[model samples]
Target: MSDRIVESCRMCESSDLESVLDLGSTPPSDNFLTLEQLNKSETYYPLRLVCCKSCGLSQLSYVVDRETLFNPDYPYESGTSKFFRDHFEEMAASVTGKLNLAADDLAIDVGSNVGILTAAFQRNGVRSLGVEPVGRLAEKANMAGAETVHAFFDPDIGQKVRDSHGAASVITATNVFAHIDDLNAFVETIKILLKPTGVFVSESPYLLDLVQNLEYDTIYHEHLSYYSVAPMRSFFDRHGMEIIDVHPVDMHGGSLRTYVAFKGAHEVSESVGRYLANEKEQRLQDPEALKKFGAKAAAHKAELFEFLYELKREGKRIVGIGAPAKGNTFLNYCNIGPEILECLTEKAEAKVGLFAPGTHIPVLGDDFLENEQPDFGLLLSWNLKNEIMNNLSAFSAAGGKFIIPIPNIEII
Candidate 1:
């Protein structure tokens, strides 16, 4: 953790911040340790949340250093799933068609992992570029058809892109907008890099879903802010941008695929008003709502640990499904380790030989399931529940049950 804490809201600069949920100190979610690194000490940081009463943005209290979090060894790849690949292609086609993009119209993706989305843009004959912070991933991305600039996205980098590649017509950021601690600079960069008529679209996990589903595990060091339409509208308006529309998507459990542009670039849609009304109905901006949210998270945590410990006492074997970043939060917060979860399995080669940080649970190849089948699978990667459930049907048929711990825990 940095020596500093965010005293104000990341979006609205509000001094009226309220403590919402504290998951305690946790290791960096993506910092899976190798066998060699396991012998060394690991870093841990306070993982706490505060809701900005002024802007209604729920954000992390402590800011983790960005370089430390997004190093060259970052293991995530956007093409890890066929589902995500298909999703990307569909999204690229949809966005391009919606924007009426031409061959010369440029598309830029911020935080493009392996250049997947940008690659989708290229396949559609749209000029695309990716701004990725991870140098190793950025290098690998060149072969994926999109040119990548390996640097943190900011006004400086945005200026560089505008100087070299020209202003972009469509600027898209997926799941990464929430990870930015300095969102003021982020929005400014968007303004700098985009054309006057350009569209700036962002997809972030919705705060409403996180609160309602008790998706506390998603609260990690990397995710600096959880946004709803209310706060987003206020934040964007202040930055001279307007959220023209909002669409609820089912990925990441639930997310907002929000479309924004320069104040008058696009017509404000009824969808924005509809979501604002829905947010009001849910009391998303109320302090009492977060207090109730904390209560629900505590209850869900208690239930999962109780069930797992009971199974442990019965000598039933348990293992984790995916050693994802969210899994690290779930494991560390619940204090589940090798004693309870024998190991975690992953489809990604980058993580196969690694171990989950804090908890020290070994990560192995997905085929390891065949070598040693555990009696129960605790799906740490529960957001991809449908994909996982579809892949592990044989295990399900063999009476090897799986546990879904979020949005209420269920054993099947």
Candidate 2:
């Protein structure tokens, strides 16, 4: 890949962007390859991190276009994980009661994968609509009774939504705010699509948690920015919005449920100030923090590969569990592939027979694990450890050991 250079910050547009960490090159996560495509060529892009000196938003310097990165085959669905499904339902009730959304008013969800939250909103008597980029997921969401538009959200789409359904009373985006490249255009559209007194609620993986846990594998082409409360205050203020509330949610490692509204439309919560102060004390936005992250990542990579090598030397049969996107980053960055593990198993039928993009490791189904019963399992989706452990109790009963790759490599 040729060098795709970005001189300025994505959020603040300041030329004083500083390089912090680099994860080398990686293929688009979620780009699981078909059998025929595997024998063909695959592209990789630079995975790097840089910080905005002006606004403190950390982001990837080399950006892959949204259309190519979010290609039609993106296979994530919110309903896959029981945690997200239940969490969304709770969020729907909380926000509905907090904002007092009526049956006649609209709730608009952006990047609404499989419309899990949108459906939740509808179930609670609030009418809901979704804007999704992937066609297949959108189609499935519509089939499942969630009104969704198969297109990316932009200012033009916002206006069309307004013309068709009127301004939305509540705007929600979950896990998609960090993936947007053009921050300016997106917030402008949100401003246009929101009712004067409406609230915009969003959730994103917290930067402090990523650093604390050394969760560097979350860095990928799709995630353009890493956010903290310190930066968001200024970013929203510049776009004619105010940060009203910040609630730390423990899922996805750790994430922030941020509430925003037009400037002065809502009272600024004391929680926002507390988070800003906490970020400073924790050094969440400092350039030196990622240097520590880079060091921890390097150590983890070496330790994990050493463990795998020892297992291979002992002739232990190994396979992977849950073909999560984070697994691709860890596997590819550590140079582990088909030779290191026989195959990776996942529950998703769509990914079962396919292969991970860059590493080209085969993804298998439940029956494969039941029959093969490998000597060891690599818990790639370590974040889902508790639920996965319960699901794979049979493997453990059969004397199969599982290795969890995270803040530390551990065998259980």
Candidate 3:
């Protein structure tokens, strides 16, 4: 239950950090509570963002204990969403073809949750392994036929993995890259696990998109860094690695997929330069711009809360659509609870019977939408609104509307 305030930038170790956005304190986003645990006290940590003046990297101002944040019973399962499953499948196929990986070449997925990407790699005819920290998830991945090692990824684990299965041809850290607090150590681990010619690909929510789209809800304890091409290129270059390519992917609102290789191991793509130029054009690193973003987020929060209150006054019943971890941040920040959201519907069996971390909104199966027929559904997982809305078409057909509260407050 220990946490500490970060006084220096994680990427460049710069003490010249500027506070950008402060969302106050929040309980761990994934700490879904059991009925018995609801009555007990819950811990809350500071949820604030700061930008480094030296490297232009955006990161959290506080560091929550890794053990507390990612307990053995971590509830998120990447395979639970069909959208993510399909995305990972596409990622594996694309990386395999681009790298000309053969069946003999090994692919390792770092922080592979339930081995979704690892399984996708195996399906692509390459031998794949998953490195996951949570024992429960590792066991689940093994049961699903995706061999996984249950240990936190570091130089030691990387050496053992390389010794057992040979250096990896491709290593991926999709959405998990930003969760790392120690960027330097992580890169060292990547170097140890990868062959000289191997490529390390990381996909994370781009800081540019987060600021432009007012995606403040995505700021949580687990996501330490909000990566952009400029800072990422600088960081990799310092480690004697180069970003060979960069691509924007449509996942988790918006994400940047970066391909890294040992210096001169691969040809640099024009996309990297384009992304860097775009980031500069948008003033992604300007401290003033980030402060403005914080102001915009505060304004949006007010507007959304007012709108929801108005709807409630009109006697409309509202329930949350998807109980994603980011949704917990929004719920707690906006102070929306079971009073406003009757319940939250989720597809993950693990979360269905539990309650949201801070808001304590009951999580029920998606079937609850059809059975309860609430008047309006607050789309907590707004990134997957299309998929969820399409899946819950029956709810819409029954004259129910949806409220999308991110970027803007809209009823669709």
Candidate 4:
């Protein structure tokens, strides 16, 4: 046991929680180290995914500090995945059109990783700004021509933005709402920052996908909570916001893109009711569902390890494809390293010369796939499996197989 630090639910702050699953001790999923740092005694913390019975919110008991998680040098560039950029472009067009955005409308995106979506809004002559705590990312967003504030979007910062920019017409946080530790303050800030009639959109990995697909790897330090429609609906109601719509997005494997505004700003969309009904039918609010899902996740872990070990026994060399944050979680949780995987390949130059966070597996450029073709390549960014398979055709032409773990362990 890694000396228990204070653990409480972000939603209810109820210390009365039950452990749904324990991934054991692991390093921060995104803490990719330089070669020198790799040699040091890497720090590992206990990673336990717990649930608040009072609030029905799933979270990690061990929380890493914001500064350590959101470093100035944090290297997750959303634009690296062309699929992600194109997906956001489509979303920007749809949301802007649906909200009847004008050229002068100001939109703010919280934790705008590299400002890819903000730039999409800019292309339409709309004034857009991004609030990012990571200096390098915020600066990059500014250089890309989207005004970005290099600070965390807390209630204080939200008030400042509201005072200066005058309530945002559209405020969005994509794949970041779940990481917020202070859910109450965060939602309160959203209420303070948006106009009375403005729309606030948030997208996060849906708990349904996490459970059904056994995507336990997505449970990491930065992500403090896994949200569902039931709990979030109750949460937003408490904060005086109504979920106007919920769009199911295919991005991030499966995600829920929720749109909200001041209570009674617009009639709640039928989509919200449908999703909530679906949650109830699926028993999403029950703790037993999560516990069952945890068992399924453990079975998945065992199956993946067995399949890889069998391949190794048959003298088949294995290499990894796409070094993503979740890839780190999967690799570290599954205890995969050089023994199971020869090297992890990545497209991003920032991580190309680095190593996997805790496993210390060497990350190399995609050139290795062509020069040293392995028998099978474990698709780490399996969420973007189709795009990766298209990009690495040469590897396949040389008789290579791509292994996708989530949903199920399979060779595709």
The number of the candidate with the highest TM-score is 3
List runs of model 1 lying over 4 Å from the truth.
1-3
In angstroms, the error of model 4 at 384 is 0.2
Question: Of the candidates numbered 3 and 4, which has the greater TM-score value?
Answer: 3
Q: Write the per-residue lDDT of candidate 2 for residues 1-412, one digit (tens) a residue.
A: 1234667887667888878888899998889999999889888998988888778889988988888877788877778878788999999999999999999889999999899999999999999999999999999999999999998889999999999999999999999999888888899889889999999999999998889988988888888888899888888888888899999886778889999999989898999999999988987778887678878888888889988989999999999898988789889998898888899989878788999989999999966777999999999888888888888899889898889888788889
| lDDT (Cα) of model 3 | 0.92
Give the best candidate by lDDT: 3
Compared with the true structure, all predictions reach lDDT values of: 0.89, 0.88, 0.92, 0.86
Candidate 4 residue lDDT tens string, 228-248: 887787778878888899988
Candidate 2: regions farther than 4 A off: 1-4
User: How do the residues 1-412 of candidate 3 rate in per-residue lDDT, one tens digit apiece?
Assistant: 3677889988888899999999999999999999998999999999999999888999999999999988987899999878999999999999999999999999999999899999999999999999999999999999999999998888889899989999999999999999998788889999998999999999999898898899999999999999988888888999999999999899998998999999999899999889889888988988888999999998988888889888899999999999999999999998898889999999889998999998899999999989989999999999998898999999999999999888888888
- Tens digits of per-residue lDDT, candidate 1, 1-412, equal 2445899888878799999888989988999888999899998899998888887888999998988899778898888987788878888998999899999999999999899999999998899999999988898898766799999999999999999999999999999999998889899899999999999989999999898888888898888989899999998899888999899877677899999999998899999999999999999988778988988887777888888999999999999999889888888988888999999988889999888999999998888776777799999889888898889888787778889998878988
Worst 10 residues of 1 by lDDT: 1-10
Candidate 1 local Cα displacement, residue 328, angstroms = 1.0
Q: Can you give the lDDT of residue 127 in candidate 2?
A: 92
Question: Higher lDDT: candidate 1 or 4?
Answer: 1
- What is the clash count for each candidate, in the order shown? 0, 0, 0, 0
Preferred candidate (lDDT higher): 3 or 4: 3
Off by over 4 Å in 4: 1-6
Q: Report model 2's TM-score to 2 decimal places.
A: 0.97
Candidate 4 structure, TM-score to reference: 0.96
